[model samples]
Target: MTDKTVLTERNGRIATLRLNRPAAMNALTADMLSLLGDELEAIAGDKGISVVVLTGEGRAFTAGVDLKALRDSGQDLTEGNVGDALNGAARWVQQLIERMPQCVIAKVNGFCFTGGVELMLACDIIIAAEEAKFGDTHAMIGLRPTWGMTQRLGRKVGMQRARELSFTARTITGVEAAAYGLAMEAVPLAQLDSRVDELAQAIAKNSPGSIAAYKDLYRKSENAGLDAGLAYEYETKYEIADVRERMAEILKRLGG
Candidate 1:
């Protein structure tokens, strides 16, 4: 249930994954990334698990990659190997989360910076604490994001806003993030967990097959042209064989 840096707890069909290094603000180290990947892989294979809520144990969801570890590694970025390794891990983790059949929700409790923002971009939904702060400080750190930030962030917010945030390395509060369309909602810190649970439970109550299909469909169609997206949706309709039965069930539940 708990690794040194990552803790996983399950309640019914929902699994909560916490970045456990609270003292260091859950700054990610290479070992932590590997452990997180392992945890996600295990959860992905478990059919009984339908939702995952990713959060941090302490004051920050994550302060991004552990700069101390990177500095100590002493790998020259000009040599490309070090940058490649780091970028590769980030990309793999983000893509894995995006592609998993189970829905992933980011419960942003506090600071979410640099690579942490990239992680949030990959989730299906993000519910942030009112006190949470978000930023992309890659520029300030003399680095650029290699994860999907450049692409996904723009899609989440406007291109102009994404440019302002990344270029300026400015931080935004959770309220601002919601206003900018980055998070689904922002709640008081006290209500963050309960709000996330309410949303996750609502999704969990739906048909698992339909949920999985819908998640996949949305991801696939989001990048396509409207006509193309419509065509894809039309084609995917056949993939869900129980639509009529589901509709009937809905009617029955409505006391029809």
Candidate 2:
């Protein structure tokens, strides 16, 4: 379970996953990605976990993938094994986020760049501290965003903004990211923890099945046009009510 690189804790209705390599600003390692993938799968069907928050152990959220490890391993970043390894790890993380039943949120604080941005993009919601910074450093680092960042970033912040971030490798503050729709909100560092908790709790109180259905719809309709989205909405019209049926039964049992 690569506890050194990643840590997980169940907090009532919320499950918090932490990137634990603080010495290197919690850079994503291959083992960490693998463990995270497995953990997400394990909790996918757990009704106890209504929300999941991905955060860092110390100061920075993540500096991105571990470049030193790849270089030292003599990995061929040009083509072949290196590219495959990097792509595979990134995909694992993305798939984990997509498949998890829990509402995934990114609690960002300081330096989120390159692969870091890719990870945050995977989250359903992102809450950042004022000190947080986001950037697509692939161009500057001589690498490319092959981890669905190109696909998702544009959808989140528009193509023009995406190009500017990826090509120019310019950093954006938390407030700027929020304004650009990259982050849900930017709070003071002191308020970051409480804000994440507040958001998670608000989500946790909702019916799990309803939340899951809505999340699924959001993912499917993100790229859909108005007509297609309308069809999807109509198809899932009774989703919330269907899940609420059991609520009445539970209330009856409680004599509510």
Number of the predicted model whose lDDT against the real structure is largest: 1
Q: Flag clash pairs in model 1.
A: none
What lDDT tens digits, residue by residue, belong to model 1 across residues 1-256? Answer: 3448999999989999999998888998777877788899999888788899999998999999888888888868654233665777677778779888889999999999988998899999999998999999988888767777888999999999999999999999999999999998999999998999999999887776787788888888877888988888788752555678889999999999
Tens-digit per-residue lDDT, 1-256, candidate 2: 3546778899889999888888888887787788777777777878788999989878889998888887886777774233666679779878889757679999997889889889899899999998888888888878867788889999999999899988899999999999999998899989999999999999998888778887887877887888898789778653454456777878999999
Candidate that scores best on TM-score = 1
lDDT of 2: 0.84
Worst 10 residues of 2 by lDDT: 236-245
What Cα-based lDDT does every candidate model obtain? 0.87, 0.84
- Return the TM-score for each candidate structure: 0.92, 0.90
lDDT (Cα, 0-100) at 63 in candidate 2: 90
